[model samples]
Target: MEASITFGDDALAARAAEAARELAAAGVPEALAAGDPTLWGPAAESQAADRLGWLDLPTTSRSLLPRLAELAERAREQEVEHVVLAGMGGSSLAAEVICASADVPLTVLDTTDPAQVRRVLADRPERTLVVLASKSGTTVETDAHRRLYERAFRDAGIDPATRILVVTDPGSPLEQTGIESGYTVVQADPRVGGRYSALSAFGLVPSALAGADVARLLDEAAEVRPLLALPEGNPGLELGAALGAAALAGRDKLVLDASLSATTGLPDWIEQLVAESTGKQGRGILPVAGGEPTGVPDEIVAGIATDGAVRADGPLGAQFLVWEYATAIAGRMLGVDPFDQPNVAEAKDGTARILAEAGEGPLPTGAPVLVDGPVEAYGDLPADVKDLSGALTWLLSAIPERGYLAVTAFLDREAAFEVPVPPDASFEVLTDIWAAHDAATLQGLLAVRTDRPVTFGWGPRYLHSTGQYHKGGPQDGVFLQITGDVPDDLPVPGRPYTLGRLQLAQALGDLDALRGRGRPAVRLHLTDREAGVRHLLAAAREV
Candidate 1:
């Protein structure tokens, strides 16, 4: 199951050629293959050597095949009906790609939304094995998820220890927690970062539990490893160089065209890898996956081809290795640290600050208003389409040339748009009206108005995916954050904050981070989620 890579235009091809020459001169290919720290440039001394272990995951995974198979067999013997992975970013996305093709039922819960959390908890706790995966072992969302589920299991008269698994670095707090709670603990390599750990234990454990062919995946990856050793003919190096060159040439948008049948959720997984790995220090690659192509001048398209029409033998593993290697090379070319997430901490810090300031009182609120610039409204605005239309127009008008608009929604996922609305009132309403609006109208409207790309990301989820690029990459994004009050909020077990509050804090924190970086941003809070969505859609129609 070999894969092919090609550029969408000649400009990208020429850039790849230039990048290949520069990478060769700098010995990037050899340095990467040898796991040399020099690949990190001036920061080589500060970077961790183990972070480079992902480069040899193919060879290393071969050694763990037996153990992975044993885990799969154990799960089958225990009759675990569902495997739920509680993780974020690198820890969970690759597992998702693998589980999509697996025979076992697997659900990756990465969102902090209370509704999403409840949905996962509603699953048969007795028959489900929850895998707590975090590379750092201190991820807030993962920890919170573990706490909530642990209580849920206890409430259901089931001991969580018997049905829980922990996958993390050796001696991490999570490993200790799992051991203390009498849960099975799987130690991942301490050197591998979350996004790059798809070939490591962090990925394989869940993949195996989901009944995937872990051995064959590693074998396919091993076959592609040799090609990555060369600077010129290496697919990884060539792709990386092309992306770096494209970014340098002001075509920073790396649009991915993946076969849904061949690579389920692979594009989303790549979105986080490329965005987080290369986006930093005011330079980054914005990965647009499965979105309407804006056909903008500053866009480069990359296609992923797999073996079969519906199922492939080894495309997932091959893709994991290719993108991981390419992202490392791209980081070098962009002159940024691929492994370190400097800006990601800012949002986390902001969330902490907000949590500290939060008291027993109700959450803070602001008045709704319409202004000339990016509209900052609270609760519900006037139903008159004119006022909302004016505000939306102003926001759209502010989009600069070559700039893009990111619509981030922080509404409750469970009941986002469950209102008494007529089916034929405007357009047919889907379960997620916000997504429908963004897909059917919002993106096209904004694209036509600004002549730029339009991207829509749901709250906190995008924080792990594109948040890195938003704050650390070029400050050319116009951010519109949509947040609303949840009808019924669920509290985190033994914590002062509820999941609703936590979700809002995350949304506000990231918004503050963006604004702190001087990025153009606006917030629209809705007391009524359905009405606000309708108003937004009506405004889009006016445009």
Candidate 2:
């Protein structure tokens, strides 16, 4: 019997097949034809070259190059003051990358916060240009902001079409909206996903307009392409597949995201792609990203590092303990299935509500009323909300959710009296205490403060509001520093700090400086000798 034959795009097939063979030869088992579907995909392998082949994708993204050039020219002529980018996820990531890399005066409003939107608009004049970006054009968040801006333009008696630019797929709701509104619609590449679209014009145009050397960036991306596609020798594909394989082998996968901005947005895009695409079947990877930016210089790491130190023993018993887990998270993103933690969303919602209540209205500041069970833990909690903190953590531990515990203190009677005390105000007071106690513990502690059971965060959503709180708040918090001090030391790599040490130091120091004015400070060092760190964490339950 003859084998059934499939034929179409013969040239494409041949090129992809040759590329696959090279990948296999280079040691990419995923490139090899395996019966296990988790190990490979013809579509992914097939698109490898073409995706990276674009002349413009390296410095500028494929999704936004041409339009950026046009916008730049227009800006030069129109003397445009501000460029407001609208969208979320991929739609915004590309623009963010471009703006970060560009020379233009740009601001990306990638939030659902009405106050944030009002602030951006209020900061800029009515003439500022708005770029409404959405891959599907149906994103509710983007649309909400669009409505606000559309009203602004209409009220100012400006032609909305000339002032607004829309980026979206053809035939999407956003495209229809732009068309009906008489706005210019720049169609994104139909085949490009949001994360992958960064190399497309989607990200490049805005970045270039903001003053980044987009062409050079694309050049760099292009340079990496050939290297990435080189069979087993290709670092990108090889690294990716190997990491995935390692996770599949039961090793913990962790991605140490040492980027300047902890939640700057790039990691989110990469995380999604790595997680959704690679995590197939029940046996896939478990991806995670960690940062301990407490010891290094703030400016160097975009201000993530500060004064906190990892403990000799405790939660962060050793830098390696966290490192190994980080490696596991990276592996999981690649394809390893780390034990899945549960109820992430519910925990986030509770945290949000807490923040919102504190920021918007009267907080429940009664006093620590510890009850039996989980309430007895966290000995140094305040009288007003001690139970709240313990209850939040207990609920988080009880289920699968993303929980975070923060204890802020205001030593200055004046500062404490400041209007609008947040519900978690006391939590902030303990920042240095937590950071000093155990930077790792503080990190993990925050990960467990939820009304619902929490395991870990699926993405970086919770980190968005942390920066402003760390930097802009009144000097009234001594954060507890915690870290597992096992594995002795981390490789410092030519610099004054190891990647791990740098992370821990910077994060701690910044918190220290933020509240060092008059507040008393304390640092706790959690020992990670043996399973002592976990034991301490478990002991918290008994507290």
Candidate 3:
């Protein structure tokens, strides 16, 4: 049950100690252990307090492990070979990490990318079990995925009931639908929030289905639980204190350097948890997960070490608890409600509003001037380099001292190219095609040219992951959004808009949200996905 998490330096250690004292004075640990809502600030007495059950999950998991194991056994008995988890953010990230280390095959479908959806449906549909997970039972992305997969299953002559499973809170619409549709439904603890449900059914169910040792995972978490109950030298509290103190002192970038052998997607999970929980009210801690350390004065490095020889299940469980507790404590230190995502709703509501007015007018457009085939110009500059160099110059110039550039691409990775390949092509080939259009080369060029850290995030997906940090975290991000026309758009079964339209709306919504926050941002629309990517690379070389 031993875990390793060290402070970056003596200054950080001293700041952590001071933060721990401040939290102790605020009675954060005691209030959390006692299930007192006061630790969440003035709104604790509302429904927010009722969702604090995750605070005690490590201690309560002993009762849930047996059921999770039984469910796993049942899936095996039914010959379920692949489990496709359809969820977003907290509901799927933990399962993804577990699947990375587990024996059972699992594919997490968190993106609404038409190509990704088609890939999942084409992979052993008859033998695959789709687990629709959502705390609220109404996450738009989750529901959309459910509809698409259900149609895919029906089209493939597979009974949706036999291939689908439901994981949600009791009495949720999804739960009722599962019952009416004759699908297996497993209700998660109603008291746990999505982000905090990593130790609850939302996480454990998928881990169990993936053949991970859920019992041992809970045992590891239990070990960390005791440490969290104490104020002094408590790993969770100390880590939280360090993060909070550093952020308040203007070192807001939490640069996490996780062991390559650690559980996959671990950094992504932490990014969402920290950013969504503490980034709000114009003050926030920005977690730079799995990115190259910028070494700027505003960065704090957090190293997550794992024994390279062992499976990461146990270590991952402990790490999950550590971050959950630390984030709760950090919220107290930052004086923000840790449970609510005020700005997250802004994008969601905006999307819904756009969807409601689907037929009213053309979807909101932040049109970039088309400079050439699939290449567009975003900012005013010399005509010779308007397509790529001009855009790069504008984006690079937007970066403040010590700030980073986030390249958010809304392009579908699988469909961004014009060249055709065989139907039986391997994923590696697809990846190679994607790489040709990806921002890796561009990121390197920016890093070398500007001497600033660069982060690449896929749109809609990043909206669910690091989008919080972009809007809610420190105002030090310069956003460059890349989007293009889909070769063929897929329509939502019953909705007026297509997935392509939804993607566009989301990208635009997020862009508007960032601009509303006054974070420097610009959008580039690629008319020819392949040619535009090459143009961008050419522009990077010039820079």
On lDDT, the leading prediction is: 1
If candidate 3 were superposed on the true structure by all CA atoms, what would the RMSD be? Answer: 3.8
Model 1: how far residue 284 lies from native, Å:
1.1
Ranking by lDDT: 1, 3, 2
Candidate scoring better on lDDT of 1 and 3: 1
Which digits, one per residue and each the tens of the lDDT, describe model 2 over residues 1-543?
110112132332343345435446544433221112222234333343333222223433444556678777876575667878877665665556445434345787765433345556665555478888887676545665677776677677776777788888779998898999898777766655554566555665556655666665555455544333334433333233334334433432223342443224443344434443333333333233343322211100111111111111111111111122222323334433221212222323443344455553433233323543222222233445344334434433433222122332111112112234346657666553333333144244553332311112211221222222222222222333322232434332233332233223333333334333333322223333223333434544443
lDDT of candidate 1 over 280-311, digit per residue (tens): 88888888765655667777666666221111
> Which model, 2 or 3, shows the larger lDDT?
3
Positional deviation of residue 335's Cα in model 2 after best superposition, in angstroms: 7.4
TM-score of 3: 0.90
TM-score of 2: 0.52
* Candidate 2, residue 403: how far the Cα is off, in Å: 12
Question: For model 2, what is the alpha-carbon lDDT of residue 176?
Answer: 91
* Stretches of model 1 off by over 4 angstroms after superposition: 101-104, 259-261, 306-314, 370-386, 412-445
Show the lowest summed lDDT stretch of 10 residues, model 3: 305-314
User: How close is each model in CA RMSD to the real structure?
Assistant: 4.4, 17.4, 3.8
